[model samples]
Structures are given as structure tokens and as C-alpha cells.
Target: MDYFATVLISSLSSASILLIATLGLAVVFGLMGVINLAHGEFIMMGAYSALTATQLGIPFILAIPVAVLVTMVFGALVEIIIIRRLYGRLFDTMLATWGLSLALYQGAVLIFGSVSPGIGMPQINFNVGDYTLAAYPIFMILVAAVMLAGIYALLTRTVYGMKARAAIQVPDMARAIGIDSARTNTLTFAIGCGLAGFAGAILLPIVPATPSMGFAFVIKAFLTVVIAGPVTLAGSALAAIGVGTGASVVASFMTSVAGDLFFFILTVVLLRLYPLGVSAKWRIKL
Candidate 1:
């Protein structure tokens, strides 16, 4: 029973983490149809932003807002300067974002040196039978729930959400109706990037921030988002649960590396079966 509890907790924690990481990417991809190769770099930027804010004497909790604000502004700039022109051009946008990813990685290495710093984990733990679980995972579960609720609320009950949906489904008609697709796209992208930044800040204590760290997160996040289907938070959450649980179970049976391999395999198989994603028919009217 204890072992089962441990596995369940581990799976839930992993799901929460993946959900946070993929939420922003899903939004951007679903709305803009732009595969942002630089999405992970925004996460890396968030970790660095936390570091800088803490150095400037900001509280750790407060640094999250600062990181999010900074990342959102940066995302807006990127949209205006680079992504704006490349809209609707998939290959071109991918190449451009790939270059931007490399540039951000190199810039981080140059500025922060090769290895970067990490925040200390919170000193809290709980005992479940003989197994002790870290408090961080519980906190993450809460954060994920709140974020999901927040996203749902934003989409279902806001003018921006309505405009964004309109821009996505029928940009020409929306534009004719006075909905500025450009502005909507920029805001949507910024929000997505901001979510990525928030995930990075949340992860800072768990993983060391490094230039190349984004690669791992980007792979996991992108796969999760893809499997979930674009633009659907419910789909993303369900996919995260499945992927995270499968990976955790594999890890328990073998090794972490094996778990990652299993995750990749599962992703490929699922994609082959459901090319449009598991949530293809259940798309929320955003």
C-alpha cells in the first residue's frame, strides 16, 4: 500500500510538472500554428530572471512575478520583431525560431558562464508511512491546478479570449470585424511565453539552470503538448497524467534513462494511432 501511494504521488507530481511546462507551448502552437523552437529558451530565461531578481534582494515568491513580467515583455518583442513576419510560414518560422534558440543558449552560456546557479529547495517534507515525500511536489500540484483553472477562466470569460479564438479560427473575418489579429497573436504568444517562464521559475529549485537545460524540458513539453492536442487544457492535463505515470512506472522498473526512452516510445506510438491527438474531437471552444 505504501509503495502504491508513493508511485501515485510520484506520477501526480510528474504530471503537474509536465502540465505547467506544456501549457504555454500548447497555447502558442494552437493559436499561432507556429512551432516555437525557442520556447524552451523562454523557460531558461525565467530561471535566470529569478536568479537576477534574488540577487537584487527580491523574495523568492515575489521573483516569480518579476520573471513572468520580464518574459512576457520579451515574448512580445520577439513576436513583434521576428515572429510577426513569419506568421503562416511553418518552415520559415521553425528555422527562424531555431536560430533564435541557439542564440539564446549561447548568450546564456556567455553571460552566466557554462554552469549556472540554482535556488535551494524549500526545507519541507512529509512522512507517509516509512516513505518521506518532499513538500515541493505537493506545492507543484497546487500550482498546476491553479494555473489550469486560471487558463480556463481566462479563455472562457474574457474579451481577449474571444478575440484570440476569433483570430485563430477566422483571421480574415475577424479582421474585417475589427478584431486585430496581429495584436491578438502578440498577446496570446506573450501569455504563452509567460507561462513557460513561470514554469522555469517554479523549477529553479529542483533543477540547476544551464544553457542546455532547455533542451530536456522542450522535448518533454513539446511531446506532451503534441499528444494532448493543441489549444485544449483538459487534453493537456489528461495527456500529462498518462505520460507522467507511464514514465514513472518505467523508472520504477528500470532506470531514469529507460523511463525517458519509454516516454519517447509511448509518444510515437500514441501519435501514430491518433495523428490529430487524443483530444481531436473534444476541442474546447476557445
Candidate 2:
């Protein structure tokens, strides 16, 4: 029973990263209808940023916000330079963003080298007893909780969110009402990418700071993102956390790879049974 408890607790921490990481994708899909394959690149960039900050002698806590800021700036620049042009063409957007992802990855190789960087554990984990509880992972979960709550408040209480939702519901009407669709969408994408950056930074110690680390999580994220409905942030969050925890629990009893494969297969089967996603009926006002 203690073993089970340990796995469950650990799984919550793993799920926390996925929840925070994929929430950005959900926002972009919900607000702008843009399928950005480069979202994962934002995550990679952030991880690289954290690695850079640490190498420069910065503390992890301080380096985190810096990493997030750098990533957001990068994301905004990508929006202005590449993503903006492919506004209405999803296939173009996907292809272009993917191309950009490749470029960013190659650029990372040039700048940081292909070798992965290591992030240190927090000081508190030295006293975790036999529980295997990593302080950093617990800290990550707290940050994710704060972010999730903040997003809820924004979506429900802010004017910007309302306008974004309005644009999503009726773009033509939203434009007629003086909302700049282009500007709104750019911000939306940047926000999504920014969150990815934050997620990546939080994961600095949990995973390797390799250019490819983001790639692994991105595939896992996409599986849950689409399964959560290309829209619906909450759905994505729930699915991400759920899968994260589920995978961990399964892995405790089985091989890591097998656990992941089982979860992936389970997700596909769930999708087939409910093609519209977990909360599609509730979110889509038909």
C-alpha cells in the first residue's frame, strides 16, 4: 500500500507538468483555431533558456521566470515572422510551424550543442526519507496549480478572454465589433507558447534539457490535446493530468515503455468511442 501511495503521489507531479504544458495548446486551438506544431519548440526553447541561465550562475528559481520570459519573446517573434502569414490556412500553418520547429532545433544544436544539459534537484529533497518524493516535482505541481487557477480566473473574469471567446464564436461579427482578429490571434498564440516555455522550465530537473526532450512530451501532449478536444483548456488539463498519473501508476506495476504504450492505446480507444472529446458536447453550443 505504501508503494502504491508513493506511485500515486509521484504521478500527480508528473501529471502536473503535462497539465501545464498542454494547456497552451488547448488555448490556441480554442481561441484561434491554429494548430501550431511549433508549440513544442517553445517548450524546447524554454528548457534551453533554463540551461543557459544555470550555466551563467543564476539560481533555478530566478532562472525559471527568465526562461519563461525568453520563451514568450521567442514565441511572439515567431508569431510575427512566420505564424502570422498562415492565418487562415491550417495545413500551411502546420507545415510552416513544423518547418520552424526543425529550424529552431537545428539552431539549438548550433548554439547549445546536441548534448543535453543537467538541472539540479532542489535542496529539500535530501530529506525526503524513503518516500522517493522529489521536492522539485512537488514544487512544479504547486506552480501548475497556481497557473491553472489563474487561467480559470482569466477565462471567466477578464475582458480579453471574453473578446477572444466572442471572436471564436463569430469571427466576422467580432471583427465588425472592432476586435482586431489578427492582433488577438497573435497574442493567443504567444500566450500558448509562453505557457509551453514555463512548462519546460519547470521540467528542467525532471527531464533532460535536450532539444529532443520537448519532442517526446509534445507527442504525448498532442495525443491528449486532441483527445481533450482541440479546444477546451480544462479538458486538456484533466486529460493531461489523468494520463500522467495513470501512466505512472501503470509503470509502477509494469515497464515504463509498456505503461506509456498502454496509455496511448487507451487514449485512442477512448477517442474512438467518443470522437467528439470529453467535453465536446458541453463546450460546443449546438
Candidate 3:
């Protein structure tokens, strides 16, 4: 019973973290079909934002908005200067963003050195029989759940979402209806990057802020988005849970790195079966 409970908690924790990390990437890819390889840099920025905020003596809770705003503005600028021109050119966008990712990584190293301090995990724990579970993961679960619900509400109920959806699905029609497709696209990209930053803030304690830390997250998030099918929020959630659980179960019996490899193999096999991905037929307003 104790082992089962531990596994369950571990799965939930992993799933929640993955969900938050991938949400932004999923949005950007799903709506625009633009592969922003530099997406992980936004997450790295968020981690740094949180670290800076902590150094300034600000509470960790307030660092989230700081991270979001910082990344959002940078993302907006990237969209206006680079991404906007490469809208229809998928391969070009990927290559351009890949270069941008390298630049960001080196820039971070120059500015902050190779390693920076990591935030301390909150010092609360819950006893589950013979097992003592950290409260931080439970907090992460709540944060992910709330973020998901909030995103659903924003995409489903807001005017911006309506315009963004219209712009993506039918740009000519949207423009004909007086919707500024260009502006909508810019805002959507910023929002996606902002969410990525927020996820980084949430993960600051678990993973230290580092220039290259973003790559670890990018791989998992990319795999999740691919499995979820670009543009399907529901599918993203389901994929996160399924993948996190599979990885967690394997990690219990093997090394964490081995578990990651196992999950990667599983994802490849599954993709071959569902070529269109888990949510190929689904579309959301975002």
C-alpha cells in the first residue's frame, strides 16, 4: 500500500510538471505550426527571473508574474522581428530558432556563469504511512491544475482567444472580418512564451536555473506535444499523464536516465501507431 501510494504521488507530480512545461510549446505549435526551437530559452529565462527575484528578497510566489512578463515581452519581440516573417516556412523557422537557442545559451553562460543557485524546496512534508512525501510536489499539482483551468477559461471565453482562433484557422476570413491577424499571432506567441516562463518559475526549486537546463525540459515538452498532437489542450493533458506515469513506473525500477530512454522509445513506437498523434482530429479555440 505504501509503495502504491508513493508511486501514485510520484506519477501525479511528474505529470503536473510536464503539463505545465509543455503547455506553452503545445499552444505555439498547435496554433501556428511553427516549431520554436528557442522555446526552452524562455523557460531558462523564467528560472533566472525567479532566481533574481529571490536574490532581491522578493517572495517566491511573486516571482511567477515577473518571469511571465519578462518572457512575454521577449517572445513578442522575437515574433515581430523573426517569427512573423517565417510564418509559413516551417523548416526555416526551426533553423532560425535553433540558432537563437544557441545564442541564448551562450549569453546566459557569459552573464551568470555556468551554474547559479537553486531555490530551496518548501520545507513542508506530509507523512503517508511509512513514507514521508514532500509537500512541494503537491503544491506543483495544484499550480498545474489551476493553470490548466485558467488557460481553458481564457481560450474558451475571451475575445482574444476568439480572434486568435479565427486568425489561425482562416487568416483571410479573419482579416476580411477586420481582425488583425498579425497582431493576433504576435499576442498568441507571447502568451505561449509567457506560460513557458511560468512553468520555469514553478520548477525553479526542483531544477536550478542554468543556461542549458532548458534543453532537458525542451525534449520532454516536445515529445509530449508531439504525442498530444499540436493544438489539442485536452490531448496535451492526457499525454502528460500517460507519459509521466510510464516514465515514473520505469524509473522506480531503473535509473532515471534509463527511464527517460524508455519513455522516448515508447513515444516513438506510439507515434508510429498514431501517425497523426493522439489528438489528430481535435481542435481547440486557442
Candidate 4:
């Protein structure tokens, strides 16, 4: 029972982290239609940012916003400087973002040094009995919750979201009706990157920060989006939870990298069976 409880708690934490990180991918991919392979770089930036804040002697709570804000700005700037040009070329965006990821990762190594930088956890341990939970991570979970709620409200209740939905469903029609997809896409991408950054900062203690950490996260998040259909937020979240928990279980049974490969292959098989991105007959709004 103790071992079972440990697994359960660990799974929840892993799922929560992955869910927050991947949520942005669903939104960005849905609106932009560009995979933005460098999505992981945002995570890397967040981790490094948080690490830097600690190195500068900033309080952890204050450092959270610093990580989110810097990454959001970086996300938007990358959109304007690098991503904006890749519009309408899905394959090209993939290749371009791949190159961008490589460069950004190396840049991070240069700026922060090749050694993995560890962010110190705050003193409080957020725990429920024997499970050792950290307060900062709980803060991260709350952020994800708030973000999920805010996004749902925005997409379902607000005018900007309605316009975003419009641009998504019928870009030509939205444009024909005078909607500027370029503006909306930029906003969506920035938000997505900010969300990923939040996850990174929150995950600093759990996984620590390395130049290559983002790649592991991006692979998981993108796979979740692909399997769940980037267009459906609910589907994406569910897939993240499923993948996270499933990977934890597999890793407990075997090796960690093997667990990832196992989940990847499982997702591929499941996707082929469902096709249309795990949405069954539900189609993209566009």
C-alpha cells in the first residue's frame, strides 16, 4: 500500500506538470497551425530564468512572475522575428523551428554554461502525510488551474476568444469579414509560450534545468497534442494526464527512456486507430 501510494502521488505530480506545460501547445497549434518545434525552448528559458533569479538572491514567489514575463516577451518576439515568416508553410515551420530550437538551446548553454543549473526549492514542503510535496510545485499546480480556467472562460465567454475561434474555423472567411489572423496568432503563441514557461519554472526543482530539458517536454507535449487533437482542449488535457500517468507506471516497471519510447509507440498506434487526432468525427473548427 505504501508503494502504491507513492506511485499514485508521483503520478499526480508528473501529470500536473505535463498538463500545464502542454496546455499552451494545444492553443498555439490550434490557432497558428505551426508546430513551433522550439516550444521546448520556452520551457528551457523559464527554468533558466528561475535559476538565474535564485542565483541573484530573489525570493521564489517573486521569481515566478519574472520567469513567466520574460518567456512571454521572448515568445512574442520569436513570433515576430522568426515564426511570423513561417505562416502557411506547415512543413517549413517544423524545419525552421527545429533549427531555431537547436540554436536557442546552444545559446542557453553559452549563457548559463553547459552544466545543469538547479533552482533551490522554497523552505515549505507541501505534503499530504508521507508524500513529500513541495509548496512551490503546488503553486505551479494552482497556476495551471488558474490558466485552464481563464483559457476556458476566454475561449467560451469572451469576444476575443470568439474572434479567435472564427479565425480558426475559417481563416479566409474571418479575413473576408475583416479579422486580422496575424494579430491573433501572435497573441496565441505568446500565451502558449508563457504557459510553457510557467511549467518550466514550476518544474525547476522536480526536474531541474538543463539546456536539453525542453526537448523532453516538447516531445511529450506535442505527442499529447497530436494524439488528442490540438483543437480540443479537453482532449489535450486528458491525453496529457493519460500519457503522464502511463509513463510513470511504465518507468516504474522498466527504464525511463524506454518508458518514453513505449508511450510514443502506444500513442502512435492509438492515433492510427482513431485518426483525425483522437477526436473521432469531431473536426477542426477550421
Candidate 3 local lDDT, 1-286, one digit each (tens): 9978887887789888888898898888865777999888989999998899889988999988999999999999999999999988989999999999999999999999998888889989998889988899878888888888888788778998888888988989999999999999999999999999998898998878999988988988888888887546887888888887788778877789877988898899879988888887665543
Q: How accurate is candidate 3 locally (lDDT)?
A: 0.87
Total backbone collisions, model 1: 0
Please, what is the whole-model Cα lDDT of each candidate in the order they appear? Answer: 0.86, 0.77, 0.87, 0.78
TM-score for each prediction? 0.96, 0.92, 0.96, 0.88
**Per-residue lDDT tens digits of candidate 4, residues 150-198?**
7778877888888877876777888888889778767777878887787
What are the runs in model 3 whose C-alpha is more than 4 Å off?
282-286
> Which wins on TM-score, candidate 2 or candidate 3?
3
Candidate 1: Cα lDDT at 56: 90
Better of 1 and 3 by lDDT: 3
For lDDT, candidate 2 versus 4, the one ahead is: 4
Candidate 4: list runs displaced more than 4 Å: 123-143, 282-286
Better of 2 and 4 by TM-score: 2
For candidate 2, the lDDT comes to 0.77
- Judge candidate 4 against the unseen true structure and give its global Cα lDDT, from 0 to 1: 0.78
What are the clashing pairs of model 2? none
